[model samples]
Target: MTEMATIMDCPPPGWEPLVEELARRVSPATVIHCHEPLAKRTTLRVGGPAEVYVEPASEADLAEVVKFVAERAVDLFVLGRGSNLLVRDGGIRGVVICLAHPSFSMVEITGERMRCGAGAKLKLVAVEAKRAGLSGVEFLEGIPGSVGGALRMNAGAMGAWSFAVVESVRIMDYAGRIHERPVAEVPVEYRACPLLKNHIALGAVFKCNATTREEVAQRMNSFSVKRWDSQPAAPSAGCSFKNPATIPAGRLVQELGLKGHRVGGAMVSLEHGNFIVNDGCATAKDVLDLMTLIQARAKTERGIELHPEVEIVGVD
Candidate 1:
């Protein structure tokens, strides 16, 4: 009897064929590559790679690719500006879709509302709002992410959150069905939007108030100054943990004497205890280890259960 072929001998479906097929089905979309480096894509700059990467040219193209991947039961992750994400060292398993195409970065202001694609930079949105003499979104000036990420995470800074200015949102589900829903229908909370967690945010309509351009700029500048003073300049995935209801995460870590603490190449930022910065050569494991240490210490010593605000993805 012939020996049975080993799993390696009969390898699973290769990503190349699927990527090719996706490109064919979704015209104008660019299939980047398999094993694409993820470190450079994330703010932390300390991840492995993506098995498949795609950049859709338009919302329609993104929907087509999403539907294709979903139909094949392949895992999909929609990448934003990667400001608050930590990908593991072993890398992601399936397709990683990035909506950073020019077609998805359009921002238009009409009356008191601004309609923007999800790929638009949060800073760009804030600038556009200021240019139009709009207020309310000035807090977004310091957020280092895109609209899609801001929507998904309800991203906030300087006491203002994304949902505060959000009027409506357009999302494409895993099945490639697009839905536009008013803010009332979307459940947004502290650093989370559960309803849209698995959905791809296509665009959003934001409501702003009429204000003097100077006033808007002043507010933006204030937030920028505050951020620059508090956050570290090193590569990091924003805040490492959420602020517990009782006290801010940074203060808590500082009180625990964890600031400047190091685990391998990852260190608790001396500038901001809530952040873990990668010192040029940190690995994902190093960061995870540091996080574990911080959590353990906080829970054991301070009786505080720290929760991570940064999204940790991929595998070990």
Candidate 2:
């Protein structure tokens, strides 16, 4: 609570009025008390308590919360499913907004397109697409994390990335302005995108061609087997490093003899070098050190720069 005690106790000029402002606009049930472990909310199941966590019931409530932070000049974080996040032992400051409400979890399939809110899980997207006889999203069947996080990280596997099927997206800015933009308007790179600043994604429309439901399920089954064989299913961020254009990060780490390397309680997965898993008990610093080790080894051996795919948030 050092972060909160230092910044939130006395009420700074720009952030002090947040509580009253947010309360005026939303129901009390949406707000959670202090000391709730955020680790339970994430796939990794690690980290400290959130000083204040708010789960708005609807999009209107979400908009009001965003506006409240803006009016008070306080910082706000938009969280999806928390699947790929690494929250530090020190809790986050200001407000953390969870957008997994039913209103933000809608999914609609029309023609060959699927429109899904940011909170929708990737697994759900794959299942819905399969039921609708869509072929493209089958590759994402085993990918854990929300659609928003997938778009943010350009999450991909089985020769397809999330952006490959995205037709357009809706975003909400810090000041509560909403904009709908086509895929062409947002530039995408390998595991990165031009949609990195200002706005938070609200939902997206993905264009998928038609296929038989059985074919889609079969494709998804193949992906699931691959994931189960290669990844540590315990508690981990999906992949620790982004693959280079030509070589997979896992392959590079294995080539450098860095697989199974350990730091504190974190170790590079022996099965998949691109993953760092908590063997027993691990701190954020343990994971950080392991990442650096693999990066340095790969650079010295193959001359390729390694970039993190996992989103590292909060204090180090």
Candidate 3:
């Protein structure tokens, strides 16, 4: 049977007891669910459930969750708006904490600096910057996902990266201890911030320049138009592969004659070769199979090694 037709909806074995234990430990306001379906939470809209999904109501609640996971050596996944992600069919094994409560999504401006809670939406940050007559984050308006994801990925668009505007970041370690570090102290390398992988992003402060609202609007509009013209409107986990230094990944896919290529319900978008879109009935395996096909073709036909840009997680 196809993966989509045969996938089970059960939480992992022992998840019930673990969830019961966790529920007793966390704040009452914290939203918790057992065997929470994660498909709807992602941009691709195709994945299994999180064995135990949680949305902490406050920083203290988040810390408590982290502490509980650490003490038991439980696997933990931090979900941030689920943009560039692909969860496998079996679902996650342990805890999935989403920092999406009101306290984590607040935004504040002070002089030339802006503080954004990790859960704050990128689009919202851009809008706030524009409201404050700022210019640095206009590029962020085009990117989907939260500040935490942007910080973790160092997300960039329109010639600017997430770290380029970052002044400092506040992070909580696995042990639930919080620390503040300057951007200079936090090392980042192309679409990755390694520290955030092991730590939870609480918030970040960004540096921006004073600018007229009209100028910011113009730039944002230009970027929006370009993105709309170039990207697909279908459901995708953004770009499938990272751009090779010599050529963009999309152009490479086209060069390989794989644009609009299909493997079951997953297809390379004709609008953008780098995007593998779900055609209403795609499963995680379909997308993965299509990726393998693309990789094989690119390697044999063009001697190119295409690596995925989207983060693939969960079990097989």
The local distance difference test score of each candidate is 0.88, 0.78, 0.90
Off by over 4 Å in 1: 1-13
Measured on C-alpha atoms, candidate 2 has an lDDT of 0.78
Better structure of 1 and 2 per TM-score: 1
Write model 3 residue lDDT over 1-316, tens digit each, in one string.
2111111244457665666666666667788877888888899988898888889888887888899899888889999999999999887878899988888998999987999999999999999999888989998997889999999999999789999999999999998889999999999999999999999999999999998999989989999999999999999999999998888999999988988888888999999989999998999999999999999998898888999999999998
List, residue by residue over 145-195, the lDDT tens digit for candidate 1.
999999999998777899998999999988888999999999887899998
Clashes of each: 0, 0, 0
- TM-score ranking, high to low: 3, 1, 2
Q: After superposition, how far is residue 40 of candidate 3 from its true place, in Å?
A: 0.4
Worst 10 residues of 1 by lDDT: 3-12
- Candidate 1 has a TM-score of 0.94
